[model samples]
Target: MSNSNYVLVLFYSRHGSIAEMAKFIARGVNKVTKMDVKIRQVPDVSDTTTIASPAVPDEGAPYCTLEELANCSALAMGSPSYFGSMAAPLKHFIDQTSTLWLTGRLIDKPACGFTSASTMHGGQEQCLHSMMTPLLHHGMVWVGLPYKNKALISTTSGGTPYGASHLANSTNDTTLTEDEKALCEAQGQRIAEMALKLQ
Candidate 1:
């Protein structure tokens, strides 16, 4: 298992905070020797008549494919909180994984979650939980941060043992604090390590 093995950092972002957090996590994944990361994103679903997004996004990571999701050694999912849950586009994409579930393609793989929310108390934990549910159902091992990270104990803003979290503020202008950045990197390292051992 070398850099040939990759962790899929999949996410959906509305205001860019979650996407920004994905970068630190990817940096952490890259810290481990023989490991690499692929960051992917889902498209916004349409409620109007059927319309497809561009083949490639205008910017950021390319859209995630089911093949990529099924084949990755590990997964790190991110989403912005939507009323205490994951945003609907990410959920809609996850719902399409029944075929992978039927074949057990993702079973026993390592998985972790990250989230961004509007306030300190704005359901980041719940958002993490919501992201975890599908991974659990897929039989993927859930990876979480540990309190030993120190930031978990001292953070005034977002940093959680549940995963990595960020407080984006009302205007969505808040940047990730140093504590949150460290935890994101730690989480990426942890998942890459687990994926290596599992391999």
Candidate 2:
């Protein structure tokens, strides 16, 4: 990984909702002066024990490398809700970070998480927390949105202190509510600021 100042916006999106949220979050990260953004995604996991995906994704952001994860100044991770937790693909990608953990490559870096779910009660916060656990174990600082954002108090769709979130509804909607968008942007900006301070 190049020694550059950037926040890694990493995620897995099966239905495009989390992908859209990643872009909005990237926009927020871009707002931080002098900080760049690196957006990456992980390929799907296959149960057949064959090559589940190509070495490179056909489109969208490139797959994340262990070096990129270890070298990033900060991270904004996301996933579509899977049974009140992060999807397996993202978890699998994170599971590979054991090497980083052994070396303390991610120690003290700032990290945060986000999620999107099919229902208002579809465990958005739980998914966010699930994603945070590994980062916490890696010794990264966890950043969270505060209620001062105002949107967190009024969002009927998705917004939380744990992190940014979206209620995609039953059809896997990609559109975010105004509050959700603000929260996503806020999450990006907050992580960027935290990274700068931690640097």
Candidate 3:
């Protein structure tokens, strides 16, 4: 695929909710003509020094590479909430992108964030903000869900003006509410449209 035409849906999911959200976001991106979506995930971080993650994941999306990241026309990133911040694994992957930052490869590319939390007050917005910081530092334009998206105002589970979000409940349910899905799609579509205009 041509690097210039695709949006990278990069994420890290612990209980799979974030991954499911990535799919809906990709579906929204697919609605736009002449644009494509690439879903990729980062490997889990291990605490043991001797442990090493496999080059390819045993299941789910393949690991993302720096090249794929630098070449995307836009980016949609997600991660499960970890203490009011992004999970360590996604942050680990992003920390390695100093190469892209130094060269301004992602400069002006449209980007958005998505996240999931186990409860209504589980720091979903803070996690989204954490994810957006590195993107902003890379000179990428940040895109956010607007109140115009009816779901953002109506959602009880997880929609936010900051970005798409999901309330996973304490049981860690991965199923997205209708409103959550709608906001995710809107976020995706908005980023894709913005990417095209910037191109």
Candidate 4:
């Protein structure tokens, strides 16, 4: 049951910003020798309460399997902000993980979170924290951007000491700065390193 080569970068992207961040994080995971990255996405929730998203997503990362979560060496989660919290679909997806919680499947694993918002102050931090709650219940060791990441002190776009984030705009801009990308990679590398050592 021991995995020495993988980390799961799981996320939900409504308008594509958060998905982009997840890729950057995965790229960082690939920077380490013998490390592997699995990108997983959650299915979109339907507006009709009685209906459900298809079992498979049409594009982007495949829907996450609970087994993937249980077996991954570490987790990097993301979501777009929905008024100071993660979007409903991502939250709903995480809510379905009770089996993992009961078995402590993710216990002691290194975890980090990321988010994107429509404005500069559109509750990015709150969304990151909201996403972390479930991981906390699973006994994850939380990781955040450290001062040593370089981007923490010089970023103008979407880097944060709390976690990596992107400023998706009210004007519909979705570009990530170099700093944001660097921070995302740094977070990934940091968690991957911790997971490998802890194992």
Candidate 5:
């Protein structure tokens, strides 16, 4: 299948909560018949210049390539909060997309963000915004969860108008609350539906 047939679900997770959220979002994308989802991850970044990550990861999703990112029909980006910002690995990967930005390859594509934080007030929304910044610069259409989803109003854990989120607690719990899962799916489904319409 062509890249345009799928929604790219890209994320970075340190303690696994963000990865678990990606799975639920992918489930929502699959709910849209004929639309596919691609789950990819960014490699860990290190301060030492002598060290490098492997070409492929040993577990979970493979590291995303620029080609995969540029060609996707739609995008769902997630990350664990880092001092109210996105994780460095994900930011590092995105920083390399200057080529795509120059080419406007992602222009008009539907996109959304998701995140996980250690606490309810741990800057999940800020992390989501950090993820959306580059996409907006690429001219991608931002897709966000609306108030119409009951989960948004009821979720004490992590649903937001900006995007789906998860409160991982201090233990870094990977498990999502019922509302968080639902909101994740809803965001994915909405992005997929938007992608199809754009096509």
Candidate 6:
């Protein structure tokens, strides 16, 4: 078990692709010393108001709670893009976090974001930007990989300074490129470093 403080890596992955991205980000978070990463995911959402998901996820990362968001030293939020924005499930989850905002539990913490999409131009950057909104509202510091990360310069598949991403093959679950993986690690390390400095 990790005894040191943690950077919570929270995400919602519908097609498994986003989940892979989350793992790569966590890999980056693991690179830091005396600080660990906790991977948590949200449960699925349904359009029918009467239909509800279970409290525990059947697979992938465990479902995240408001306390998870409130307690983490930092965060790396992810989601697959949907119409130039974050997916509804993640949006729904964030909508319920106003209490955290009110208490300013996230203030001054470093935060970052990531995303995946079926197509090369499927608004991945927009999705990343969309996830950044609530973090900004909470007064959390935003982080992204710098150009100094070699992958940012050579990646034709997926990877960006805005965070990290995967171009995503047709199935939308293609394995992340080496570049994408490196950038995810870079973002994690960056957030962890800042979180440590803030301590």
Query: How large is the C-alpha RMSD of every model relative to the true structure?
Result: 1.7, 1.9, 1.6, 2.2, 1.6, 1.4
Question: How does model 6 fare in lDDT?
Answer: 0.85
State TM-scores per candidate. 0.95, 0.96, 0.95, 0.93, 0.95, 0.95
The candidate with the higher lDDT, 2 or 4, is 2
Q: Return whichever of 2 and 4 wins on TM-score.
A: 2
What range of 10 consecutive residues in model 1 has the weakest lDDT sum?
A: 46-55
Off-target runs (Cα >4 Å) in candidate 2 are 1-3, 48-51
lDDT score for candidate 2 against the true structure: 0.91
Off by over 4 Å in 6: 48-51
Model 1: residues >4 Å from true position, as ranges?
Answer: 1-3, 48-52
Residue pairs that clash (backbone atoms under 3 angstroms), model 2: none
Write candidate 4's Cα lDDT for 1-199 as tens digits: 3345689999988888888899899988877776789999988778753227787887888899889899999999999888899888878878889999888899999899999987888999999899888899999989898998888889877877778989876525667888888999998888889888877
Clashing residue pairs in candidate 4 are: none
User: Against the unseen true structure, what C-alpha lDDT does each candidate score?
Assistant: 0.91, 0.91, 0.92, 0.86, 0.91, 0.85
Candidate 5 least-lDDT 10 residues: 44-53
lDDT of 4: 0.86
What is the lDDT, from 0 to 100, of the residue 157 in candidate 1? 85
lDDT of predicted model 3: 0.92
Q: Stretches of candidate 5 above 4 Å error?
A: 1-4, 48-51
Q: Tens digit of lDDT per residue, candidate 6, span 104-163?
A: 999999999988888889999998899888889999998988899888999998887788
